[model samples]
Target chain A: MLGLSITQWLFGTLSLMAIMFALMMVFTRSPVNSALYLIMTFFCIAGHYLLLNAQFLAVVQIVVYAGAIMVLFLYIIMLMNLNADEEPRKHVLTRAIAAIIGGMLLFVMIGALRGAEQLQIVQGGASQIGLVKNLGKVLFTEFLFPFEIASVLLLAALVGAIMIGKRDTNINTK
Target chain B: MLNGIPINYYIMLSAVLFIIGAVGVMARRNAIIIFMCIELMLNAVNLMLVAFSTLHNDANGQVFVFFIMAVAAAEVAVGLAILSMVYRNFKSIDIDLLSRLKN
Candidate 1:
């Protein structure tokens, strides 16, 4: 029998991976390495979705975030030929302010989460309800327009990227 | 004896991740790295959403996470484009150097 406690442990492990990889992505000096680590972080987040019983979402997260978006990032990073030379050092004051703000955000999120425990608990498994079909139902019936608009935005982004990434022959000629 | 964690644990972890990302954003000079840090914060928020969704046994939060992921994809695409443009003009992705916007 699958126990709730066991499931929680599984999620806890994946969460640890996610957090560590995220920190790596942020703290790394090399943008190329950071981008690759971010891909790992995305995969861990997908694992969390699977733990939550959102099978469709888990797959989608992998497909969209890990698969497509990350490859896009890698492509751009490589295409730009951005190596160690491009990054510059920041001032101490900026770093200090960032640390202070980061500490505050951490405190607030923890406090809010503690408060959530006092709130009423919900009891039911949407995971058991056939996630993919149900999600499609909602997308088509209720969130159809939003779904279409999302595609539209993606389309615009695609065009815009091509436009920007296109080699500037005009400038080269001059 | 390994399953002692509650939903709160996950939430706390997410909070820490978010904070780290925030620090990277404010402190890091590289525009691309700062953007990656923003993505980290967003993923951290997604982690919290999925955790709560699991705790409550509700799929709505998970659904919201899906939307958030979509939006994040869009944002990254556009933002990276802008950054590349900044690079094209300035030759460096340093945030502090892109001061005048026109220059």
Candidate 2:
């Protein structure tokens, strides 16, 4: 007992789980297993959103990322019949260099963020901005134009996916 | 100070996650796995945005996160479609083998 409160405990646990699963996703060779691990990571992130009191975003994260996007990923993997770990291994030197580069990047970012602790965050008591009603109001009122554009983007993506995924029937007939 | 948990913790967590994703992207040859790593990076950024939203006691950051999710979803759709098309044409999805465009 480090005298930590329940929220702090939960945050620690969720973040640890998230990092572990994310690493597993990367390390696993099987695409299906990688996808499963990524889904677990998404769930942990949803938990963090809940801890942040962003109820709407938390629900959306679960619904969209864990539910829809991951399902699509799995569906594609299955459709392609790529359930095995058939990926050709990269050279050891390449892997080592990538790891070193990533480590350096992390070091630089953490160094830049050293003063983050001193930055004062406003402590607004019992903020309700995370509620659906408040978020919906902001989405519709101030962010209305972007909201509509997102819809159009979704539509374009829908049509484009269908067009790209469909087989070339004309070539087959010839 | 969210329940005595410093905002720095969230920042540190996201930074680590983002690095892991970047490494995965750099090291992996599978296109699907690379795409998943990109998603991981996006989620890391999303976490940071939500944390800042709570820090500022504002909803705007959360709104930005919403738009980001939409864009990510659309991106996944088109990317997967292209991936499947590549598979159909080559009977494989290895990124290294798809280097005909380099010529």
Candidate 3:
């Protein structure tokens, strides 16, 4: 050990904050509050990306998740016109069944994890460097086709979404 | 890497986060919150990808993470638009209320 207590302290505090917000997001009753908590979770994940030396990903994580996607979420929430009075309350039987199903899922996950092959995680510091440029190179060179395909898919999805969202004036005219 | 923290620690942290997100999805009835949980899950996967990249000592994981970010962005745009449409018609974003398309 190099006696860098500050590093571990920082990482541990950040991880704790991330976990807290994640749990809050799950339990928060209001969708808007849940969305806000999820943003906090995204910010902490960006911090993790930075810790892992992926500075570019850290920036993209903020720009994409925290900034863009979260804003979109807030916009939808605003458009939905939700209030405390009208939200449907789940029946007691349904809630009980849900809890049972969730417990079973947890049990399965624990069993699967217990038997899973352990990845031999190498220990110690990495000498790796040059994150952005290297990632860009691989993205453009090796993953070029997949990237282009994703773009095409996005375009198609955009057209489909717009068509679905468009209002039909002919019905009103009739 | 500090104090010999193994790659599994990072992966495990993300895996736990992913499970938390999944539970959120199951418990939440709101569409936007469910979508947020999905994004959380995606971010967790991205965390594991970067960790694995460092483990195998390759930059490909970072590249994949970037592509995922792009796809996620696209998905959010399209998803929010649909949500807004559903809201315009139903005046609500509850998953239970979105039964117009169920048939």
Q: lDDT score, residue A152, model 2?
A: 100
Per-residue lDDT of A38-153 in model 2, one digit per residue for the tens?
99999999998888888899999999999999999999999988865466678899999999999999999999988755543333246688899999999999999999999999
Q: TM-scores, in order shown?
A: 0.84, 0.95, 0.85
CA lDDT of every candidate: 0.76, 0.91, 0.76
Candidate numbers, best DockQ first, in rank order = 2, 3, 1
Per-residue lDDT of model 1, residues A17-133, tens digit only: 887888788777788998999999888878766766677878888898878878877787787787766567677787787888888877776666665654322222534522888
Which residue window of length 10 is worst by lDDT in model 2 chain A? A116-125
The ten-residue window of minimal lDDT in model 3 chain B covers B1-10
Model 1 residue A72 CA deviation (Å) reads 1.5
> How far does residue A121 in candidate 1 sit from its true spot (Å)?
7.8
Off by over 4 Å in 2: A119-125
* lDDT by residue (tens digit), candidate 1, B9-98: 666777787888888888888887888888888888887887777666666776678788888887888888888888788787778887
Could you tell me which 10 consecutive residues in candidate 1 chain B have the lowest summed lDDT? B1-10
Question: In candidate 2, what are the lDDT values of residues B1-103, reduced to their tens digit?
Answer: 4445578888999999999999999998889999999999999999999988988788999999999999999999999999999999989888898899899
- Per-model interface RMSD values are 3.5, 2.1, 3.0
Q: List the residue pairs that clash in candidate 1.
A: none
DockQ of 1: 0.49
